[model samples]
Target: MADARSTAAYLCGKLYATLWALGVLGTAAPTPSPLTPGRDESTARFPRDELKRRLAAAGAHMITAKGRGGDRAQAASEVFRSIPDLIPVAGLPQKRYTNQEVLQFSQGCAAQLTTYREKYGSLLH
Candidate 1:
């Protein structure tokens, strides 16, 4: 049946999304490997002001930049950037990574988030 097929597809997608969030599909090896094993790239090698300058070079501003308003993907990236490494999630520290690395991890988080929104949002809303 059409309804049955839709339901099954949805369930499979949901399960896949959850597994991906759990990092079953991530690049790094399974847990116990330090998520960020190195020193802070900016602080360790560059001065704080220079680090800010590099982030600005990367198009990040203390004030939100243009063309990003209402763009969920961009907004998700900003949220991800704001996360500190001190915060731990799923047995990983959120810090000590390069901006690029953090952003990559954020893409996975955002995908999982989007999937969750698709799955349970209508019910909760």
Candidate 2:
């Protein structure tokens, strides 16, 4: 039998492949909703607004926890990994996000927060 890490990796790979096969891992193309003519439901339901809120909250928490020297990127990554439901879009299982993807998304969120702070000052204050 494969070691625990190898088995986990193998399972994760299979899961990703299955998600792709089901067309759940590609670009979120717009699909018009009959009820909301002219509006793409997929885009409408994306969790961007929620994500921003969560990122800001996480940033605030990190700042409070470590003052100015806190690692916001690492904190954001951990928050996202621990709370997958914070992500707005859906279809794939929560475990679908690989560690790399979580890191990338967290880093992106952290960068966006940094830019916002540079322009508008601290979010918490």
Candidate 3:
């Protein structure tokens, strides 16, 4: 389960932690989980417009949040470029994934993560 919104949010988080590790950023309060009874956003596939809004929000968080005065905009741009552009109403296909499958997908995504200093964290990319 990894829709555009959730996947973009996950990428934002991965980039944030990378920045933190590079000692160029500060942390803010934790974001509320998109999980709860009767609802799990990770599996939710939103429309194209909504996806764009969510992407904008993620980008704003990266660029506008307190981050040791580093140029986070470039980092955000680089991280987001890993995913397909969210456009077209006939958007991505949805899949209801098992917990383990989701975990594997997330690990795969992390392995392909990009940082400011490298095109990708894993050389296999």
Candidate 4:
């Protein structure tokens, strides 16, 4: 169970890192709020914060399932299924992306899934 929790944490960390690298996550520095008209809140949460929160919640669920002697693999799979919802469309004018960007994002997702399988294939049973 401890191993399952550790694996889930590790997987989530890697996914977060990949999202950051792809600019799917917000900038390290907080931007000024348009509502504030020039006042920048260093502690302001960005749109990506919701995605992070969801991921953390999913990780917690994975841990909880393992602790309760449920199928950790199924719990982890549920977390994986929720990942697509993390892609933000809040600020977009339209639900359209450039072809190159879409291709790159798809490739990145494939790579991340491959990494996950490599790391947790045995435990996922």
What's the TM-score of each model vs. the native?
0.26, 0.26, 0.35, 0.34
Residue 47 C-alpha lDDT in model 2: 25
- Candidate 3: which stretches are off by over 4 Å? 1-27, 30-56, 62-71, 85-93, 98-100, 113-125
- The collision pairs in model 1 are 85-94, 85-95
Candidates sorted by TM-score, descending order?
3, 4, 2, 1
Q: Distance from true position, residue 44, model 4, in Å?
A: 27
Worst 10 residues of 1 by lDDT: 19-28
TM-score of 1: 0.26
| Model 2: CA > 4 A from native | 1-95
lDDT of 2: 0.33
Q: lDDT tens digits, residues 1-125, model 2?
A: 43432233323222222222112111134322111335422212332343344344553444443443334333333333433332324422334345544333434334434443454343222
Query: Pairs clashing in candidate 4?
Result: none
By lDDT, rank the candidates, best first.
3, 4, 1, 2
User: Model 4 TM-score?
Assistant: 0.34
lDDT of 1 by residue, 1-125 (tens): 33422232222222223332222112123432112246333332222242333333433321232333333334334433443331223323224545543444434434545754564442112
User: What is model 1's C-alpha RMSD?
Assistant: 16.6
Instruction: Give the range where candidate 2 is weakest over 10 consecutive residues by summed lDDT.
Output: 18-27
Pairs that collide, model 2: none
Candidate lDDT values, in order: 0.33, 0.33, 0.38, 0.38
